[model samples]
Target: MNLSTEVRRLRDMDWGELDIKESGGWPFLLQLICCVLVLGLTLAGTYWYLAAPKLEELGQARTEEARLIRDYQSKAAQAAHLEVMREEMAILEERMNTLRDMLPTGAEVPSLIDNISEAAISNQLSIEFIRLRSPVSQEFYVEQPFDIRVRGGYHRIAEFLANVASLPRIVTQHDLTLEPMEDAGGEQLQLSMLARTYSYRQSGEEEEAP
Candidate 1:
Protein backbone atom coordinates (compact mmCIF):
# COMPACT_ATOMS: atom_id res chain seq x y z
CA MET A 1 0.00 0.00 0.00
CA ASN A 2 1.06 3.67 -0.51
CA LEU A 3 2.44 5.56 2.56
CA SER A 4 -0.53 7.92 3.05
CA THR A 5 -3.13 5.10 2.72
CA GLU A 6 -1.11 2.94 5.23
CA VAL A 7 -0.96 5.82 7.76
CA ARG A 8 -4.70 6.58 7.41
CA ARG A 9 -5.61 2.92 7.77
CA LEU A 10 -3.44 2.54 10.94
CA ARG A 11 -5.04 5.62 12.54
CA ASP A 12 -8.63 4.55 11.62
CA MET A 13 -8.26 0.98 12.91
CA ASP A 14 -10.63 0.07 15.79
CA TRP A 15 -9.14 -1.89 18.65
CA GLY A 16 -12.62 -3.32 19.57
CA GLU A 17 -12.94 -4.87 16.14
CA LEU A 18 -9.70 -6.95 16.56
CA ASP A 19 -9.73 -10.58 17.87
CA ILE A 20 -6.68 -12.59 18.98
CA LYS A 21 -7.90 -15.72 17.19
CA GLU A 22 -8.51 -13.74 13.97
CA SER A 23 -5.13 -11.87 13.91
CA GLY A 24 -4.31 -13.61 10.61
CA GLY A 25 -7.23 -11.77 8.92
CA TRP A 26 -6.29 -8.35 10.42
CA PRO A 27 -5.46 -5.39 8.20
CA PHE A 28 -2.08 -5.57 6.43
CA LEU A 29 -0.56 -2.56 8.34
CA LEU A 30 -1.98 -3.78 11.65
CA GLN A 31 -0.34 -7.17 11.27
CA LEU A 32 2.95 -5.55 10.39
CA ILE A 33 2.70 -3.27 13.52
CA CYS A 34 2.06 -6.30 15.73
CA CYS A 35 5.12 -8.11 14.38
CA VAL A 36 7.30 -5.01 14.89
CA LEU A 37 6.10 -4.57 18.53
CA VAL A 38 6.81 -8.22 19.38
CA LEU A 39 10.25 -8.04 17.74
CA GLY A 40 11.11 -4.82 19.65
CA LEU A 41 10.08 -6.38 22.98
CA THR A 42 12.14 -9.50 22.30
CA LEU A 43 15.25 -7.49 21.41
CA ALA A 44 14.88 -5.35 24.57
CA GLY A 45 14.57 -8.42 26.83
CA THR A 46 17.58 -10.10 25.23
CA TYR A 47 19.71 -6.96 25.54
CA TRP A 48 18.93 -6.62 29.27
CA TYR A 49 19.89 -10.23 29.96
CA LEU A 50 23.17 -9.97 28.02
CA ALA A 51 24.26 -6.58 29.35
CA ALA A 52 23.45 -6.90 33.09
CA PRO A 53 26.57 -8.93 34.06
CA LYS A 54 28.87 -6.63 32.02
CA LEU A 55 27.39 -3.60 33.75
CA GLU A 56 28.03 -5.23 37.13
CA GLU A 57 31.59 -6.06 36.04
CA LEU A 58 32.19 -2.46 35.01
CA GLY A 59 31.06 -1.29 38.46
CA GLN A 60 33.44 -3.79 40.12
CA ALA A 61 36.33 -2.58 37.93
CA ARG A 62 35.70 1.00 39.03
CA THR A 63 35.74 -0.09 42.68
CA GLU A 64 39.05 -1.95 42.17
CA GLU A 65 40.58 1.11 40.54
CA ALA A 66 39.64 3.25 43.56
CA ARG A 67 41.23 0.73 45.99
CA LEU A 68 44.45 0.57 43.96
CA ILE A 69 44.69 4.35 43.88
CA ARG A 70 44.42 4.52 47.69
CA ASP A 71 47.15 1.89 48.10
CA TYR A 72 49.47 3.73 45.70
CA GLN A 73 49.04 6.98 47.59
CA SER A 74 49.94 5.31 50.90
CA LYS A 75 53.05 3.62 49.48
CA ALA A 76 54.14 6.83 47.74
CA ALA A 77 53.96 8.70 51.03
CA GLN A 78 56.17 6.01 52.66
CA ALA A 79 58.66 6.19 49.78
CA ALA A 80 59.02 9.92 50.36
CA HIS A 81 60.42 9.18 53.84
CA LEU A 82 62.46 6.18 52.75
CA GLU A 83 65.88 7.70 53.52
CA VAL A 84 64.88 8.72 57.06
CA MET A 85 63.56 5.22 57.71
CA ARG A 86 66.79 3.69 56.45
CA GLU A 87 68.90 5.95 58.68
CA GLU A 88 66.80 4.99 61.70
CA MET A 89 67.26 1.35 60.82
CA ALA A 90 71.03 1.81 60.60
CA ILE A 91 71.11 3.46 64.02
CA LEU A 92 69.17 0.59 65.53
CA GLU A 93 71.55 -1.93 63.97
CA GLU A 94 74.56 -0.11 65.39
CA ARG A 95 72.96 -0.07 68.83
CA MET A 96 72.32 -3.80 68.61
CA ASN A 97 75.96 -4.47 67.69
CA THR A 98 77.21 -2.37 70.62
CA LEU A 99 74.98 -4.32 73.01
CA ARG A 100 76.22 -7.59 71.56
CA ASP A 101 79.81 -6.54 72.18
CA MET A 102 79.04 -5.52 75.75
CA LEU A 103 77.68 -9.02 76.39
CA PRO A 104 80.65 -11.37 76.23
CA THR A 105 80.48 -14.78 74.58
CA GLY A 106 80.88 -18.00 76.64
CA ALA A 107 84.48 -18.48 75.60
CA GLU A 108 85.45 -15.14 77.19
CA VAL A 109 84.08 -15.99 80.65
CA PRO A 110 87.41 -17.14 82.15
CA SER A 111 89.26 -14.16 80.73
CA LEU A 112 86.60 -11.88 82.18
CA ILE A 113 87.04 -13.46 85.60
CA ASP A 114 90.81 -12.97 85.31
CA ASN A 115 90.21 -9.33 84.48
CA ILE A 116 88.23 -8.93 87.70
CA SER A 117 91.12 -10.35 89.70
CA GLU A 118 93.51 -8.04 87.88
CA ALA A 119 91.25 -5.10 88.72
CA ALA A 120 91.39 -5.90 92.42
CA ILE A 121 95.20 -6.34 92.33
CA SER A 122 95.62 -3.06 90.47
CA ASN A 123 93.77 -1.35 93.28
CA GLN A 124 96.30 -2.85 95.83
CA LEU A 125 93.62 -5.10 97.36
CA SER A 126 94.57 -8.67 98.32
CA ILE A 127 92.23 -11.16 96.60
CA GLU A 128 91.12 -13.77 99.15
CA PHE A 129 88.81 -15.69 96.87
CA ILE A 130 87.17 -15.04 93.46
CA ARG A 131 84.78 -17.96 93.10
CA LEU A 132 82.60 -18.58 90.00
CA ARG A 133 79.14 -19.96 90.58
CA SER A 134 77.31 -22.17 88.11
CA PRO A 135 75.92 -20.31 85.13
CA VAL A 136 72.19 -19.69 85.28
CA SER A 137 70.57 -19.89 81.84
CA GLN A 138 67.99 -17.35 80.75
CA GLU A 139 66.01 -16.74 77.62
CA PHE A 140 68.82 -15.10 75.61
CA TYR A 141 71.95 -15.24 77.79
CA VAL A 142 73.54 -17.01 80.76
CA GLU A 143 74.09 -15.21 84.05
CA GLN A 144 77.56 -15.99 85.47
CA PRO A 145 77.51 -15.05 89.12
CA PHE A 146 80.70 -14.72 91.23
CA ASP A 147 81.21 -14.92 94.95
CA ILE A 148 84.02 -12.48 95.65
CA ARG A 149 85.92 -11.86 98.93
CA VAL A 150 88.73 -9.34 99.30
CA ARG A 151 90.73 -7.62 102.01
CA GLY A 152 91.69 -3.96 101.74
CA GLY A 153 91.10 -0.45 103.05
CA TYR A 154 87.68 1.06 102.34
CA HIS A 155 89.08 3.48 99.72
CA ARG A 156 90.93 0.67 97.95
CA ILE A 157 87.75 -1.42 97.76
CA ALA A 158 85.93 1.58 96.32
CA GLU A 159 88.71 2.02 93.74
CA PHE A 160 88.47 -1.69 92.82
CA LEU A 161 84.73 -1.51 92.23
CA ALA A 162 85.16 1.62 90.15
CA ASN A 163 87.73 -0.17 87.99
CA VAL A 164 85.37 -3.13 87.59
CA ALA A 165 82.66 -0.75 86.35
CA SER A 166 85.10 0.75 83.84
CA LEU A 167 85.79 -2.66 82.24
CA PRO A 168 84.98 -3.05 78.52
CA ARG A 169 82.54 -5.85 79.19
CA ILE A 170 79.39 -5.45 81.28
CA VAL A 171 79.74 -6.56 84.94
CA THR A 172 77.37 -5.73 87.77
CA GLN A 173 78.16 -5.94 91.51
CA HIS A 174 75.49 -6.87 94.03
CA ASP A 175 74.91 -7.85 97.72
CA LEU A 176 77.96 -6.25 99.30
CA THR A 177 78.82 -6.94 102.96
CA LEU A 178 81.76 -5.51 104.94
CA GLU A 179 83.25 -6.57 108.31
CA PRO A 180 86.23 -5.26 110.25
CA MET A 181 89.26 -7.56 110.30
CA GLU A 182 90.46 -7.52 113.99
CA ASP A 183 93.79 -9.14 113.09
CA ALA A 184 94.82 -6.18 110.91
CA GLY A 185 94.41 -3.74 113.83
CA GLY A 186 91.02 -2.67 112.43
CA GLU A 187 92.85 -0.87 109.55
CA GLN A 188 91.62 -3.50 107.01
CA LEU A 189 88.09 -4.57 106.18
CA GLN A 190 86.86 -7.79 104.56
CA LEU A 191 84.51 -7.07 101.70
CA SER A 192 82.27 -9.86 100.53
CA MET A 193 80.32 -9.34 97.31
CA LEU A 194 78.16 -11.22 94.79
CA ALA A 195 78.88 -10.11 91.24
CA ARG A 196 77.11 -11.05 88.00
CA THR A 197 78.26 -11.05 84.40
CA TYR A 198 76.32 -12.02 81.30
CA SER A 199 77.42 -14.14 78.34
CA TYR A 200 75.65 -14.49 75.03
CA ARG A 201 74.24 -17.93 74.16
CA GLN A 202 75.48 -19.41 70.91
CA SER A 203 72.88 -20.15 68.27
CA GLY A 204 71.64 -23.82 68.06
CA GLU A 205 73.20 -24.47 71.48
CA GLU A 206 69.77 -24.53 73.09
CA GLU A 207 68.88 -27.88 71.52
CA GLU A 208 72.25 -29.36 72.45
CA ALA A 209 72.04 -28.23 76.06
CA PRO A 210 71.78 -31.13 78.55
Candidate 2:
Protein backbone atom coordinates (compact mmCIF):
# COMPACT_ATOMS: atom_id res chain seq x y z
CA MET A 1 0.00 0.00 0.00
CA ASN A 2 1.31 3.45 -1.06
CA LEU A 3 0.06 7.01 -0.51
CA SER A 4 -2.04 6.85 -3.77
CA THR A 5 -3.64 3.61 -2.71
CA GLU A 6 -4.49 5.21 0.64
CA VAL A 7 -5.97 8.24 -1.14
CA ARG A 8 -8.01 6.00 -3.41
CA ARG A 9 -9.36 4.07 -0.43
CA LEU A 10 -10.27 7.37 1.34
CA ARG A 11 -12.06 8.65 -1.81
CA ASP A 12 -13.99 5.43 -2.07
CA MET A 13 -14.91 5.38 1.63
CA ASP A 14 -18.64 5.09 2.54
CA TRP A 15 -19.71 7.85 4.92
CA GLY A 16 -22.91 5.99 5.99
CA GLU A 17 -20.95 2.96 7.29
CA LEU A 18 -18.73 4.77 9.82
CA ASP A 19 -19.18 3.86 13.52
CA ILE A 20 -17.78 5.87 16.46
CA LYS A 21 -17.52 2.66 18.60
CA GLU A 22 -15.15 1.09 16.02
CA SER A 23 -12.68 3.98 15.79
CA GLY A 24 -9.65 1.61 15.72
CA GLY A 25 -10.88 0.06 12.44
CA TRP A 26 -11.73 3.43 10.79
CA PRO A 27 -9.81 4.97 7.83
CA PHE A 28 -6.73 7.08 8.65
CA LEU A 29 -8.48 10.35 7.70
CA LEU A 30 -11.39 9.68 10.08
CA GLN A 31 -9.07 8.77 12.94
CA LEU A 32 -7.03 11.92 12.35
CA ILE A 33 -10.20 14.10 12.35
CA CYS A 34 -11.39 12.47 15.59
CA CYS A 35 -7.99 13.13 17.27
CA VAL A 36 -8.06 16.82 16.19
CA LEU A 37 -11.63 17.30 17.55
CA VAL A 38 -10.70 15.71 20.89
CA LEU A 39 -7.55 17.92 21.14
CA GLY A 40 -9.60 21.10 20.46
CA LEU A 41 -12.22 20.22 23.12
CA THR A 42 -9.47 19.46 25.72
CA LEU A 43 -7.70 22.80 25.07
CA ALA A 44 -10.98 24.75 25.37
CA GLY A 45 -11.85 23.03 28.69
CA THR A 46 -8.35 23.68 30.11
CA TYR A 47 -8.53 27.38 29.20
CA TRP A 48 -11.94 27.74 30.90
CA TYR A 49 -10.67 26.11 34.08
CA LEU A 50 -7.20 27.75 34.37
CA ALA A 51 -7.19 31.16 32.63
CA ALA A 52 -10.75 32.48 32.91
CA PRO A 53 -10.66 33.11 36.69
CA LYS A 54 -7.33 34.92 36.44
CA LEU A 55 -8.68 37.20 33.68
CA GLU A 56 -11.70 38.06 35.83
CA GLU A 57 -9.45 38.89 38.82
CA LEU A 58 -7.31 41.12 36.62
CA GLY A 59 -10.40 43.06 35.56
CA GLN A 60 -11.44 43.52 39.23
CA ALA A 61 -7.97 44.78 40.15
CA ARG A 62 -8.10 47.40 37.42
CA THR A 63 -11.47 48.63 38.66
CA GLU A 64 -10.19 48.87 42.25
CA GLU A 65 -7.13 50.80 41.12
CA ALA A 66 -9.30 53.33 39.32
CA ARG A 67 -11.43 53.82 42.46
CA LEU A 68 -8.34 54.33 44.61
CA ILE A 69 -6.96 56.91 42.18
CA ARG A 70 -10.18 58.92 42.31
CA ASP A 71 -10.21 58.85 46.10
CA TYR A 72 -6.61 60.08 46.30
CA GLN A 73 -7.34 62.96 43.91
CA SER A 74 -10.33 64.10 45.98
CA LYS A 75 -8.35 64.02 49.24
CA ALA A 76 -5.43 65.88 47.65
CA ALA A 77 -7.76 68.63 46.47
CA GLN A 78 -9.13 69.02 50.02
CA ALA A 79 -5.61 69.06 51.47
CA ALA A 80 -4.64 71.97 49.22
CA HIS A 81 -7.33 74.17 50.85
CA LEU A 82 -6.57 73.12 54.44
CA GLU A 83 -4.57 76.25 55.39
CA VAL A 84 -7.24 78.60 54.02
CA MET A 85 -9.91 76.67 55.92
CA ARG A 86 -7.97 77.00 59.17
CA GLU A 87 -7.49 80.74 58.67
CA GLU A 88 -11.22 81.22 58.11
CA MET A 89 -12.01 79.26 61.27
CA ALA A 90 -9.58 81.39 63.31
CA ILE A 91 -11.11 84.64 62.04
CA LEU A 92 -14.58 83.36 62.87
CA GLU A 93 -13.51 82.45 66.42
CA GLU A 94 -12.02 85.90 66.95
CA ARG A 95 -15.23 87.57 65.75
CA MET A 96 -17.25 85.38 68.08
CA ASN A 97 -15.07 86.40 71.03
CA THR A 98 -15.53 90.07 70.21
CA LEU A 99 -19.29 89.63 70.09
CA ARG A 100 -19.33 87.73 73.38
CA ASP A 101 -17.40 90.54 74.99
CA MET A 102 -20.04 93.00 73.89
CA LEU A 103 -22.62 91.04 75.89
CA PRO A 104 -22.49 91.40 79.70
CA THR A 105 -22.48 88.57 82.30
CA GLY A 106 -25.24 87.72 84.80
CA ALA A 107 -23.51 89.46 87.75
CA GLU A 108 -22.69 92.54 85.72
CA VAL A 109 -26.27 92.99 84.47
CA PRO A 110 -27.33 94.72 87.74
CA SER A 111 -24.66 97.41 87.33
CA LEU A 112 -26.08 98.41 83.96
CA ILE A 113 -28.69 100.47 85.80
CA ASP A 114 -25.90 102.53 87.36
CA ASN A 115 -24.54 103.15 83.92
CA ILE A 116 -27.86 104.58 82.71
CA SER A 117 -28.16 106.64 85.90
CA GLU A 118 -24.70 108.09 85.38
CA ALA A 119 -25.56 108.96 81.81
CA ALA A 120 -28.68 110.83 82.97
CA ILE A 121 -26.88 112.64 85.80
CA SER A 122 -23.99 113.68 83.57
CA ASN A 123 -26.51 115.11 81.13
CA GLN A 124 -28.13 117.30 83.90
CA LEU A 125 -31.32 115.23 83.98
CA SER A 126 -33.05 114.22 87.26
CA ILE A 127 -33.27 110.42 87.53
CA GLU A 128 -36.82 109.70 88.72
CA PHE A 129 -36.40 105.95 88.94
CA ILE A 130 -34.57 103.03 87.27
CA ARG A 131 -36.11 99.59 87.68
CA LEU A 132 -35.11 96.14 86.41
CA ARG A 133 -37.58 93.85 84.71
CA SER A 134 -37.56 90.07 84.49
CA PRO A 135 -34.92 88.53 82.21
CA VAL A 136 -36.22 87.17 78.91
CA SER A 137 -35.27 83.73 77.61
CA GLN A 138 -34.27 83.35 73.99
CA GLU A 139 -32.81 80.70 71.75
CA PHE A 140 -29.18 81.82 72.12
CA TYR A 141 -28.84 84.62 74.70
CA VAL A 142 -30.70 86.28 77.63
CA GLU A 143 -32.25 89.69 77.13
CA GLN A 144 -32.22 91.98 80.20
CA PRO A 145 -34.68 94.85 80.00
CA PHE A 146 -35.08 97.90 82.34
CA ASP A 147 -37.40 100.82 82.66
CA ILE A 148 -36.06 104.37 83.13
CA ARG A 149 -37.84 107.64 83.95
CA VAL A 150 -36.17 111.06 83.93
CA ARG A 151 -37.16 114.69 84.01
CA GLY A 152 -35.13 117.28 82.07
CA GLY A 153 -35.04 119.79 79.25
CA TYR A 154 -35.44 118.45 75.71
CA HIS A 155 -31.73 118.85 74.86
CA ARG A 156 -30.67 117.09 78.09
CA ILE A 157 -32.94 114.13 77.37
CA ALA A 158 -31.47 113.84 73.88
CA GLU A 159 -27.94 114.00 75.32
CA PHE A 160 -28.76 111.27 77.87
CA LEU A 161 -30.02 108.98 75.12
CA ALA A 162 -26.83 109.61 73.12
CA ASN A 163 -24.73 108.75 76.17
CA VAL A 164 -26.63 105.50 76.68
CA ALA A 165 -25.84 104.60 73.05
CA SER A 166 -22.11 105.05 73.70
CA LEU A 167 -21.93 102.56 76.64
CA PRO A 168 -19.27 99.83 76.50
CA ARG A 169 -21.89 97.07 76.57
CA ILE A 170 -24.67 96.91 74.01
CA VAL A 171 -27.95 98.72 74.96
CA THR A 172 -31.08 99.65 73.07
CA GLN A 173 -33.99 101.94 74.01
CA HIS A 174 -37.61 101.14 73.11
CA ASP A 175 -41.15 102.48 73.68
CA LEU A 176 -40.11 106.02 74.55
CA THR A 177 -42.63 108.59 75.94
CA LEU A 178 -42.34 112.27 76.85
CA GLU A 179 -44.78 114.61 78.59
CA PRO A 180 -44.79 118.13 80.09
CA MET A 181 -44.18 118.47 83.87
CA GLU A 182 -47.22 120.87 84.31
CA ASP A 183 -46.03 124.35 85.23
CA ALA A 184 -42.50 123.61 86.57
CA GLY A 185 -41.67 125.26 83.29
CA GLY A 186 -42.78 124.66 79.69
CA GLU A 187 -39.24 123.47 78.90
CA GLN A 188 -39.30 120.71 81.57
CA LEU A 189 -40.55 117.26 80.44
CA GLN A 190 -40.51 113.67 81.74
CA LEU A 191 -38.99 110.91 79.61
CA SER A 192 -39.82 107.22 80.06
CA MET A 193 -38.32 104.39 78.06
CA LEU A 194 -37.51 100.73 78.23
CA ALA A 195 -33.85 99.79 77.74
CA ARG A 196 -32.54 96.31 76.85
CA THR A 197 -29.16 94.57 77.17
CA TYR A 198 -28.01 91.04 76.40
CA SER A 199 -25.90 88.39 78.11
CA TYR A 200 -24.45 84.99 77.17
CA ARG A 201 -26.11 81.87 78.61
CA GLN A 202 -23.94 79.93 81.03
CA SER A 203 -23.11 76.22 80.71
CA GLY A 204 -25.84 73.69 81.56
CA GLU A 205 -28.52 76.39 81.14
CA GLU A 206 -29.92 74.85 77.95
CA GLU A 207 -31.75 72.14 79.90
CA GLU A 208 -33.83 74.80 81.64
CA ALA A 209 -35.09 76.18 78.34
CA PRO A 210 -38.75 75.50 77.58
lDDT of 2 by residue, 10-113 (tens): 78988888777887877677677789999999999988998899999999999999999999999999899999989999999999999899899878877777
- RMSD per model, one decimal: 6.8, 6.8
Model 1 Cα lDDT, one tens digit per residue, 12-120: 8888887999988777888998999999999888879988878999999999999999999999999999999999999999998898899877788889989999988
Q: Work out the TM-score per prediction.
A: 0.61, 0.60
C-alpha lDDT of candidate 2 relative to the true structure: 0.88
**Predicted candidate 2: what Cα RMSD to the true structure?**
6.8
In order, the Cα lDDT scores of the candidates are: 0.89, 0.88
What is residue 54's positional error in candidate 2, in angstroms?
A: 20
Clashing pairs in 2: none
How many clashing residue pairs are found in candidate 2? 0
Each model's total of backbone clashes: 0, 0
